[model samples]
Target: MTTTAPTATAHRSGRRFETARQVADAVLFEGYVLYPYRASAAKNRMRWQFGVLVPPAWAPAQGEHSLQRTEVLMEPRGAATLSLELRFLHAQRRTVQEAHADGTFTDTPALHLPDRVLVPWDEGTEERVELRVAVPELTEKEIVLPFNRPAREDTEPVLDDHGRTVGRLVRRTEEAEGVVRLHAEELEGPYRVLKLTAVVENTSPWTPDGPGTAREEALPRSLVAAHLLLGLTPGSFLSMTDPPEWARSAVAGCANLHTWPVLAGEDGRADVVLSSPIILEDHPAIAPESAGAMYDATEIDEILALRTAALTDEEKREARGTDPRAAAVVDLAETLPPEVLERLHGAVRSLRAGTGAAAAPQEPAPEALFTPDTPWWDPAGSAPAQPTPDRVLVDGTPVGPGSRVTLRPGLRRTDAQDLFLQGRTARVEEVLHDVDGGVHLAVTVEGDPGADIRREQGRFLYFQPDEVTATEEP
Candidate 1:
């Protein structure tokens, strides 16, 4: 949906919105290029890995999707207004052309020049659409807003020191179209809760050439890294990942397809929500120590910087010519100071007593955990240097090695596989403690065929004390 102007509420929220934008920017370009940022790199060949909204005509054939739907709960104090900002990337083709002697330009995959090398690659251009609507209006009927971008082409002539036109760079963009549909429904709960549903669909009319059309061929007409930022005034949004006790039933009824919504912006502020294709917890923020975008979000900045710095001169030149952003990454790594590199090595966000551990008399500063004599990597260097205990207390019972317990993986910290282990009986193999003084019980499934083999190999599933209940031996 497109709004010609920003509403007053949007103006007031500019500061808070900037915080969300920083994180959204990271998601937008994630995997745009990988380490060793060269166009010829194998990993770089396959692009647009996240939140790709392809044209409807090609989605079914390609086994991809063309739409994202998000349902979130919001509590409005009075007449609440909602503002949405949809952001995505439009893939643009950049072709390197060499100027012929006879006043003609021919396309070439790579054009070599004395100063720098030019290579053909696909680049992304940012697209944003904003919409504002009153809560009452959405309850009446669904609102559909259509947006379109027309095809575009641009060329820049490459020059020589003698002021002669040597070659040219041509950039072309395909047309794209989409629609945003929004509506709201009131819940039956005692609180004034409204379930907001938003849908983003790719309405581009482009069709595939044939059944064999590859993903790269269809990406030109697709929306790359599409996501939404929702803002509410005089209202607050409930967390879908962790809802309040009263709204648990209503939250369970909400259906979110291909998109996960979580609280955004500053911590403890529920006025904004970020709907993303990648699953994330509430109030996600970009690491402060990061120098710039490396396009590989899962990789650490220190490792990427060191690897980028180790690239050969010729490789660096090619990477710089691949794309403008890639060039910035090369420059950042080459010029990064030692102190900044050290900062990227690590940062502790929080420290608390582990489950079933005694409360400390006083919380220790983060710096206190490190010392000149003992390195941070050494497990025994930190406070509570004793080895792991042979047993741990579960419901006031000393469940030591060989104790039997029923797994009850908590929803907050367990994965899908852990859910399947719920209520299964297991034998405690050992008790371990982490640097933070948290307790973990290693156990092997009772009936698994490989249980004996796993014990010999020292591999077992671990659970916190609170996630398991002691059971009497048969």
Candidate 2:
């Protein structure tokens, strides 16, 4: 008989998070809420903008609904249990004091204030929540879970540099929980597709006032910014759609890979904060939009441009003393000094010169090494790798610089290495040679969903000759 270890401890190799700091860094992404943590940011005038459920009558009219459904791929080896920890932000509208342009500060004379989303927890309310899952082979089922109000007694108030009270700091709270059990007999084989639905009804007793009242804003009866965390029994894994861009390489490596939507740093390091109770044996599949390459700006060149674009000349100089990160980026941008605008104009001039024409390559270094080893400290006694010529033929098809090819299925150099989607075509931009004289092709796959240092630098994906099939002209 197989004994099951505790869900959290079963995967000793997995990542853990003790705080929701990392979780919030990921959850509060892309329009979840506006800055200043208030409801006033121009981008956040509309609350409950994402991952929210409004009242049935009000939802349909607002192009929304009370329920959300998403599917997950599960691999079950035996009787197992699936658990979920749900979290969300609960806010209340309250009266506030505002300072006018004319230098007068006064109470708005109303119970509710404009552009304010306050955290008001009764500290004793319990919420009843329902979670359900269904598969083609089984009937729809539900589990009821009671969610407690977040504990806020110890919440510290926030202050600015001038000792002014800005607001209070509120951590993400567990609004509800549920667990679903699966039996081996219920499984068709090793894999099953489960459609999971989490449902929550507005049970808060506080009613929102509308226009004409002292608090003249029409608010939802209950507003929440919802999120979910899934825990699977040991030996089972789950996958979801819309993986984060950084996790695409892992997901593409296997034909039968299981994935879950989890946030990860660009360095591919999983969050170690232990924010959730469940430990997944494999890295969770990320949502496509999470930590996008453009938004994160991991490359030095990209970082420099993004950070310096908005700075005033004075601000740029002050950044050197005030912000080390911004200062470093600005410094790097100064070093590039490339004529990008001229390069664009040159391209247009060359286009008229001839079709399918391109600029000449830069000259090689002045001192070419025999074994491709520079005087820059080659390890003692290590054999130098051989170098390849500028071009080569692959699989009876000519695949050199400027050629196109498709990646073969199941070709992986490492677990996290980008796998060109099977049969997807890419351009062979460069042919590189290693010290051992090994030939490697650097190609950029078209529409690849993966993100890596190479993509950040606009570099090519390197693959062995055996991994690609040279394609003829379009």
CA lDDT of each candidate? 0.86, 0.40
Candidate 1 residue lDDT tens string, 1-474: 333333312223466578888888988998888889999988899888999999999999778999999999998778888888889999999999999899999998788766457999999999987788888877877877778888999999988788899899999999999988888999897788999999999999988889988887778888999999999888899999899899999999999988889999976689999999888889898877788888875577999999999999889889988988999999999999998898888765434222222335344332233223444343554566456678889999899889999999997774788878989999999998886789999999999999999999999999999999999999
Worst 10 residues of 1 by lDDT: 2-11
Backbone clashes for every candidate come to: 0, 18
| RMSD in Å for model 1 | 8.9
Error of 1 at 156 (Å): 1.6
| Local accuracy of candidate 2 as per-residue lDDT tens digits, 1-474 | 121223312222223222333443334332333222223334334544444444344443445544443233344335544544444444333333444556444543221212222333111121222232222212233333434353232334434466655544332332222222322223233234333333344333333243233211213333344444444443233333334454344334423111124432222332211112222223333332222211121223234354454555544453342222334544544443445312222111111112222323332321222222324333663477455577788878777987888877453555444442567888787788775668888887776565355556867767788888888877
Alpha-carbon deviation at 407 in model 1, angstroms: 26
Using alpha carbons, what is the TM-score of model 1? 0.76
